[model samples]
Target: MEDIAEAAAYGVAAPSAASSGAVRRPAAAPVAAGAPPGMAAAPAAPAPPMAGGLAAAAPPSAPRTAPPAEAAPVMGGVLQKEALGLVEIVPFRGVRRTMARHMAESVAKQAQVTTMDEADVTIIKRIREKERTVAAERGVRLTYLAFAIKACTAALKRFPRLNAVLKESGEEFVLKRYYNIGIAIDTKSGLVVPNIKAADTKSIFEIAAEIVDLVDRAEQRHLGVDELHGGTFTITNYGAIGGVYATPVINYPEVAILGMGRVRELPVVHEGKVLTRLLLPLSLTFDHQLIDGAEAARFLNLVMSYLEDPDLLLLEGA
Candidate 1:
């Protein structure tokens, strides 16, 4: 029984009472220093007693085998977590690397500034609701992006500087007569922005259909290299992903980029009475070197006015 108890204390299975009482417990092995807690090896057995019951000291020539109380913060500590799992590594591809470098260079070179304002899109939403059947009959989806693109093109026409590009040599600001707006599309391959060529001439329904086609092609990685360039201005709708507002980086060679945030209903004052209004957050980031804050604010105000009353879009002959 005593031998069985001793064996049990040493983590060994105990022998049955009917078995021999001469069972012996093996000496515990020495644990290395720095091992994780609860995983350290057991200490070596104590030296046996000699003639007068004094423990015999180990020989001077014998090497010490006892582990330290704490590990030295080396291999054993690192291996402790290895018992679980490790992170997988992925290599960076050319497209993603080029995007990273371009974005970094844009930030480094451009004199960037961002201005934000919220537009009351209640009227536009109501108009879309009323025209839903007509749009469906025309086989087009009347999205906020279409309205935004329409409004943006009109604002760019009124404020051409916002749609222009600055020369790298600082020779002159080249104002573009053509209006091509780039829509930033997030795809599985990467982010691709394919602009609507001569977007100013397209109607709201036409813009909607084109947007759908461009987004589909971008996601499927079927867009041509030419479609990726020649954008005068860019617009990215972070609203689709529930983003409120973000300072989007300018596509270099283009003077500005606009970000649309998620629309939410909030109480607003109208005619001295509080009313719930659907507000769309707008963030316009531009090159501060070429455009001033006042001009940018005016451009934003124009876009907001057009959005607030979408009828002005047709009235402007846009």
Candidate 2:
């Protein structure tokens, strides 16, 4: 409270000092013509000199001048339409403004490029179909998001370049050996991405449990500052919001971000036969200055492979 008050007080002028180093008296207002002798206004005395032999100070008040007349409207005297009646301004404050600045900086600083692809998630769908019941038994909801997180972590281990940050000097890449995937959660306050640390070592069930807890707490606004930082990679699933595909902006400092779109059954050609398979749209946006288009495509392929074949994830002991 004191800090806020101090900040507000900053730039405000203090009371003018008098000759005796006391508060200066305000000049009297003008008196009426018929005022009594005692009520007559006296001429203000010249300001006294400083004790250090400086010149006399000037009067605090200056003569007031009339403001300039309003300028005439230009363009052949034509008047502009007033949209102020319909326009409304809602203040963007606190974390919302911070989020906006962060996004703007990310767009301004990185040479972003998005490469999109669709993944055949029939295998992950089948696994989730069986695990949902087991997850319910353990009091956790098994979601495709958990599977996506697992797949992303595995892919990061294989393509570690995507899991690194480029230094400001652009001389070297700071490759992070640890895998921490920030999960973008939509909360009442706004969007917040609190990452899961050491995500590569966690299993599907464990990741699902953490997802449930992190999302619950994130929505409740109980997540600490520590939970919001140190992400090696980020994943934003617009699937829940019914978006098919979007070019998600890369989270700053991190080389890349993977956007997951809504999963639906689509007719795809499978070995000379058209069959309906559950497909998930993936949009991988990366810093072109750090990773090439080919590398981004390969990274997306590895992630898709993990989702397309659940056995690989299990064989890796995830």
| Strongest candidate by lDDT | 1
Which residue runs does candidate 2 get wrong by more than 4 Å?
A: 1-84
Clashes of each: 2, 0
Give per-residue CA lDDT, model 2, range 1-318, as digits (tens): 432332222224211111122222444455534566337446766677788988677756655444334333332232332546222223454444556677898998899999999989987778778777898998898778888899988888888889999898889999899999899988655677889989988888898999888998876666766677889999998888988889998889898999999999989898899999999999999999999899999999989988888789889875
Candidate 1 segments exceeding 4 Å error: 1-88
List RMSD in Å for every model shown.
Answer: 18.1, 17.0
Would you estimate the TM-scores of all the predictions?
A: 0.74, 0.73
What local distance difference test score does each model get?
Answer: 0.79, 0.78
Query: How well does candidate 1 score on lDDT at residue 56?
Result: 97
How well does candidate 1 match the true structure in TM-score terms? 0.74
Model 2: residue 132 alpha-carbon error in angstroms: 1.9
- The superposed Cα distance between candidate 2 and the true structure at residue 225, in angstroms, equals 0.9
159-263 per-residue lDDT for model 1 (tens digits): 999999888887799999998899998875556678998988999999999998898776666676657778999999999999888899998889899999999
